[model samples]
Target: MSPAKAPAKPVRILLAKVGLDGHDRGVKVVARALRDAGYEVIYTGLRQTPEMVVDAALQEDAQVIGLSLHSGAHMTLFPAVVSELKKKNATDIIVFGGGIIPDDDVEELKKQGVAELFTPGTPLQDIVEWLRKRFPSS
Candidate 1:
């Protein structure tokens, strides 16, 4: 019989609250959930600019970038984040978002390359499962 294969490393995710959004209770909860689920989470507190978010993700070598938005700036903020990631040649990182984003904007954000949207009330396990499937390291 062949030797057993080793389990893959947990995905590293950077969770950020960008563009002056001061309410981070949701992001904090999700960050803890991701950590408990075995992901290495780098939480970039509140009021981060898009550039800062990308920089931190790059510095941390994160495989995923999760943005928590609630300031009604998803339209401007998400695109700005994506654009900065492109400029830095870091577009390979899977980008996801969750917040009070409207349905139309969620579609538009997905079209702009957001991997998924975790709206209010989304189960925490759903996010973890999605990441594990999308970024399995084994």
Candidate 2:
């Protein structure tokens, strides 16, 4: 008989709200969805800086950092987080975001190293499945 398959790795994702963006409703919802989907989620409360977010992600040993922004500062905050990650020599930790980012800036963000960006209506299941695909078990 064939051996049973190994359990999939539990993806550890750190979710955060950076800078003066006080909005938390959406990030809270996403955190719950990811938890229900069986991923370890760390939701750092509102008013965090890019450095604080990166530091927490590192301390938590998270594989991914999910930043949610609605303050229209995606252009600044997102890249700052990515830069902090690079500065800390934690490039392996992937970064993703969701918010009111303009479509025009998507490519630039990607070039600056953001892995994905979900618009307002992106299905939670899509987020779950995407993480699964990104961190499939051996």
Candidate 3:
């Protein structure tokens, strides 16, 4: 008889809106989608700082962080989140984001340790599928 393998832990993701961006409808929708997809999601709500996002993720023991931004602060805020994660020695935590970011900035963010970027209008299924592949339970 084959030995049974232990069940994998549920993928936990922390979703946050950093900087002064107050719009949160999109992030809330995403949180619901991720939750439905079986990911344990933590929503940090609006106007969070990068430090706050990282602190929450650490406290929650999240494996990923999904940032939502609309204040044109991708250049500043996204990198700040990445930097804070590095400082916390939590570089294993995957980072990704979506918003009205420009193509050029998307590449820049990816180069700066963001695992992925989803611009507005990308399907939510795409995000869920990416996570499924990135962190398969099997």
State TM-scores per candidate: 0.91, 0.91, 0.92
| Model 1 vs. true fold: TM | 0.91
Write the residue-wise lDDT of candidate 1 on 1-138 in tens digits: 996543466678899999878899999999999887777889978999999999999999998999999999998998899999999999899899999988999999999988899899999999988987886662
Rank all candidate structures by their TM-score, best first, as comma-separated numbers: 3, 2, 1
C-alpha RMSD values across all candidates: 3.9, 3.8, 4.3
Candidate 2 TM-score over all chains jointly: 0.91
RMSD of 1: 3.9
Task: Pick out the ten consecutive residues of candidate 1 with the lowest summed lDDT.
Answer: 3-12
Per-residue accuracy of model 2 over 28-74 as CA lDDT, tens digit each: 99999998877778888998999999999999999999999999889
Enumerate residue pairs that collide in model 2: none
Stretches of candidate 2 exceeding 4 Å from the true structure: 1-9
Q: Name the runs in model 3 displaced over 4 angstroms.
A: 1-8
Model 2 score (lDDT): 0.90
* Candidate 2 vs 3: which has more TM-score: 3
lDDT at position 75, candidate 2: 95
Q: Top lDDT: which candidate number?
A: 3
Backbone N/Cα/C clashes per model: 0, 0, 0
- Model 3, residue 125: C-alpha shift (Å): 0.3
